[model samples]
Target: GEAGRAAALEGLERKVKAAMRSTTLNRLAPDLEALVRAETIAVQAGPRPSADESVLAEIRGAVLAGRPLSFIYSRPGAEARSRSVAPCGVMFGRANYLVAADRESGRIQTFRLDRMTSVEAGDGLATPPADFDLAAFASQSFGIYQDEIEDVVLRVTPQGATEARGWRWHPTQTLEDQPDGSVVVRFRASGMRELAWHLFSWGEQVTIEAPQRLKAVMAGELAAAGRALSRAQS
Candidate 1:
């Protein structure tokens, strides 16, 4: 009985993993699609960012074949340059990125798919490090951009405490209720600039409690806004 139960659990786990990997709406059953359409509405305000489908296909093939990739990449405000990297996987978020490692230096990096051109897979075999984990690598940053990680601490005022408690700020985040009806949220992450941008909307309800870098970035953003407002008034 125990062995039979274990086998059934393993089969169910495999099916769950397979379902999680199937992302497109077209993969949903007709009834499920109708239910989703009736219950959900996405309010995208602008054109959704996308990568070249052909380039994505080329990179996906290279990753699956354990081959290296060569492409010309153009970073923002920079000239285009040639690159050779070992494809690890693709991360789809606000934008699509190729998570890869330099063939020569072995340094892992993320390249935006939209900025890539003339993508070609190499004949030589290349693969991610045996211990490389795509999800763990992506989680190191608050958003897409990666930098030095820090212990981030925030204090949400009583007015926003309930909302903050219900929010999923980060995968590693933990919230603690304060005696004064406030809440303290703590998490370790990078991408301070992006975090600063998000904190702007919280107004006075959120207070930065640690990591001087985030505080400085928030202050800089506030000063820039102040200058823009003054110019508009003048």
Candidate 2:
């Protein structure tokens, strides 16, 4: 029911070529509708970050050509400015991002693809750092932004333990079955706030067992949320 990336791209190409042949909007409208609103083959776009495919395509091309990219990056409450960055790779997670090393600082950074403007590829081949690994860089953070990685341990209540067994908490997680019918989840990760927010959804079914930092974060988030609710009620 859901179209994969390759299939979706191919379908889009077909729709574009069909539109190009028509001279007027009314003339192209019918054919375009049929291609998109198919009767038998229902096309569904799966969960992926929204952005201009044109920009993504250009970056993909630059990566293949081993060339750097230039673009005006916008920061919140600040002016937009241009930067040349070595094209390391494009990472797709909750959102899409261009991960690279700033040509100035030589330190790696991530720019949200949606915030980029006036993108252009450099003439010279991109020279990434000798020891930079995209996977390693990404894995340093529990979610997106990097922080101190710590050993996180969570003990699931007996009632929720069965369901938690089927959950993939993390790629590098270890799950241990306790004789008391509860499960202990352990993993090394950063981004305590994100983890805390997620565990809130578990609704007391999950309990923190170690890493004082995670417990502190969870308590802080709970207190903040409580204060907001109190203010709203008052």
Candidate 3:
């Protein structure tokens, strides 16, 4: 199984290298020229989020040039507003986000690429803080949206311990085997809403032991589901 996965990764890497050689991709990411020429393997799961190619090109160019960006960002149920930020980096997961710092507040924020309009690069140069590490910043959250970080603990029943042991929950997660044959999973992260969404799939196999916020979020989801089922029955 491990060998098959390795082969698949290698094949994907070859395909990516081939794709990066295209005129369009090369133009969009000239900084990646050296990277594409190097040997590397990368594999990702889940559906890739889609965004405007022109918007992505603009962001990439700004990031490469260490320039600030101006755009109009709109969130659901909120009025669109203009924003100016120094481009830090872009993170691609189930959704693509521009992780940038607010020009006025100097506070870091994430804006979905799909939600941005009228994207323009600023004239003045800007860059991330000297101590800023993209990987470290990304690891602070369970998902893309960052909030208050909390110590999360999950207890997996004996029936699910085997599966849990093999799963990588988070980069900072540690697994502890219990005398009762169960497993305790612990990590520090944010994005309780996303965590609650994932825990729904586990049914009763997993139980949250800390972070009242996550427990409350899970309860709220359960109550909402109950209400929806009641409405359906009527």
Candidate 4:
């Protein structure tokens, strides 16, 4: 996809160059030269296509047209597999495409565009709920897959909060200062794996404030990791 987008940009650059070359009139030389330089610079600065544009285009068209699109897609750290999906919509964020698919499982499945290949659109269509909003859907998500929605509150130490303030992991993140040199972040999200992983990276600087289930899971994971390390040395 990156290659395809880059190639498309390159094609535009060539056209601009050809136009500049074809226009030999000295009267418009100054403006044409400036335009040519600008085009060249823009082309150079454009992001390289890391995804297949055709796949993106086809998927997007199908979603908007209310048709089912099929493709070979893979999850993070997974092998690509063929999937037929009734796409509710397409979302672009976190440098990946999030597609809502209707399946026997009530939870929606998210797909990474870079992992998709040979995407095709089918004629069958399904209208998504009028209330469905992709942006709102991803407001609290860290990556793609959203399984179970819940309100997750986290208390970050002042130092941790300071580090988190500059970066936005979720759009719905709400921050509040704490007296004990910490901050509380309140947000609603479904998938917590990525966030759990992020919290683990912070060590003990942050603490889970709500949803005892997640906190317990996180604690268990850390405890198991500690035991694994202890066993390795013993």
Candidate 5:
């Protein structure tokens, strides 16, 4: 999918360059060529081909057409299951996700696109609920895992403020610069375990300021990790 999008962008760039070359007078050619070269290079960020392009296309077309879709899904430690869903929207980021309404539960669900073994159009078209907001749904979680949502607050030390200011923790994150040169970032999010794992990267630079549950989870994670290390050494 990325490859296709890149190719399309490249093709349009070529057309624009050809038109500019043919229409501009000789006096303006050098300036126009220089601008074109700069933009062309800027647009050439690396993108790769999708592993399951056809399956993605099937679900994408269904979502666009307000149609339902059926797919065979599988993941580690789980039985391969078949599902029918009312396609709502598709989200692409670090990994692609299919945001849809489950036919049985009638609740919105997110599916990893790569986990889908096969996808096809279902019989009747089903329009997504008017109240559904794909962006809001995805932002409900700190990471992809869906869990109890909590108000998360982190206090970054003065030493980590510069780097923390540049880091985006969530779509709804709020960063406040303290008078002491430290920074406090707050965001309401789900996936506590995932958040704890991410905070490990910040190490001693960050402290959990709110949500006692988050601090507990972080301690549990460290304890479990220590036990694992001990077992491995034994």
Candidate 6:
């Protein structure tokens, strides 16, 4: 049984190595490495103070036992704050372990593992609601933004479409070919800021459809640029 497990792992590694030979995966490999290195460096080259392993172990135990935790957390650019939350799940985001918490407001919150300064297990909090669905919660989410969901449709010109032919933007994305030698891509996203910026980078080759608001935002940006050019000429 042990030998069989080792062979299975080696087979999986080979498949991963084969997949990484593709262009998109190859480009992302370095960024993934950097993220891991950054997390390791933080843990290794820390100041005299280090995170308490006992606290971490207790937090893990609480999560497994469906208990709550109160901890001091500091946002990337904000002051440190105290929070009381019920532990739900732990997920790996890039190289960080994100702890999902059920807040007092009945909404779920995610906290970065490295940003937690102090953690303490608390008295038993209510377990996740009977109807709580983790898969649906993350279905339309792009990265961590989960405010509102929008139907985004993009028309990419032939050249741009060719560039995106085999790329996977999201699991639910649908790509269709249009008669005018352009490609139409449609997907539902909870956050559009990242996708909007990505489409904007394609310059005039991509057009935003369906959501008039996105087009309006792009038009305003172009108008501002025109005004800036006019001011410079004068």
Query: For this target, which candidate reaches the highest TM-score against the unseen true structure?
Result: 1
Q: Which sections of candidate 5 miss by over 4 Å?
A: 22-51
lDDT of 1: 0.87
> What does candidate 6's lDDT look like per residue over 37-67, in tens digits?
8885334432233334455576677777877
Order by lDDT, highest first: 3, 1, 5, 2, 4, 6
Instruction: Give the local distance difference test score of model 4.
Output: 0.71
Clash numbers, per candidate: 0, 0, 0, 8, 0, 0
When 1 and 4 are scored with lDDT, the better candidate is: 1
TM-score of each: 0.80, 0.72, 0.78, 0.68, 0.79, 0.63
Which regions in candidate 1 have their CA more than 4 angstroms from the true location?
1-37, 45-47, 228-234
lDDT of 1 by residue, 126-184 (tens): 99888899999898888887888989999999999999999989999999999999999
* Candidate 6 regions with alpha-carbon error over 4 angstroms: 1-59, 95-101, 200-203, 212-234
lDDT of each: 0.87, 0.83, 0.87, 0.71, 0.83, 0.69
Tens-place lDDT digits, model 4, residues 1-234 = 357667889999778767774555555779868997888432433223245667777877887788777778766787778887777766654456646656445346677777777788887665555567767776646656566677888887777878866657576778888788788888878667667767887877778887776787687788888999999999
Local accuracy of candidate 3 as per-residue lDDT tens digits, 53-109 = 678778889999999899999999999999889999888778889999877667778
Cα error, residue 83 of model 5, in Å, equals 1.0
6 Cα displacement, candidate 1 (Å): 36
Residues 118-201, model 5: lDDT tens digits: 689877867677788877888899876667789999999999999999998998899999999999999999889889988998
> In terms of TM-score, how similar is model 1 to the real structure?
0.80
**Which of 1 and 5 is the better model by lDDT?**
1
Instruction: Please provide the root mean square deviation of candidate 4 (C-alpha atoms, Å).
Output: 6.5
TM-score head-to-head 1 vs 5, winner: 1
State model 3's lDDT. Answer: 0.87
* Candidate 2 local lDDT, 1-234, one digit each (tens): 113466788999779777674466668779879986776644444334645767877788887897889999998999998889888887886677898887767787888887899888879878678899989888766677657888999999999999899997877799999999999999988888888988998997999988999999999999999999999999
Please list all clashing residue pairs in model 4, or write none if there are none.
1-49, 1-51, 1-52, 2-49, 2-50, 2-51, 3-49, 158-181
Listed per candidate, the RMSD to the true structure in angstroms reads: 9.1, 7.8, 9.4, 6.5, 4.5, 10.9
The residue ranges of model 3 lying beyond 4 angstroms of the native Cα positions read 1-48
Q: State the lDDT at 14 in candidate 5.
A: 78
Worst 10 residues of 1 by lDDT: 41-50
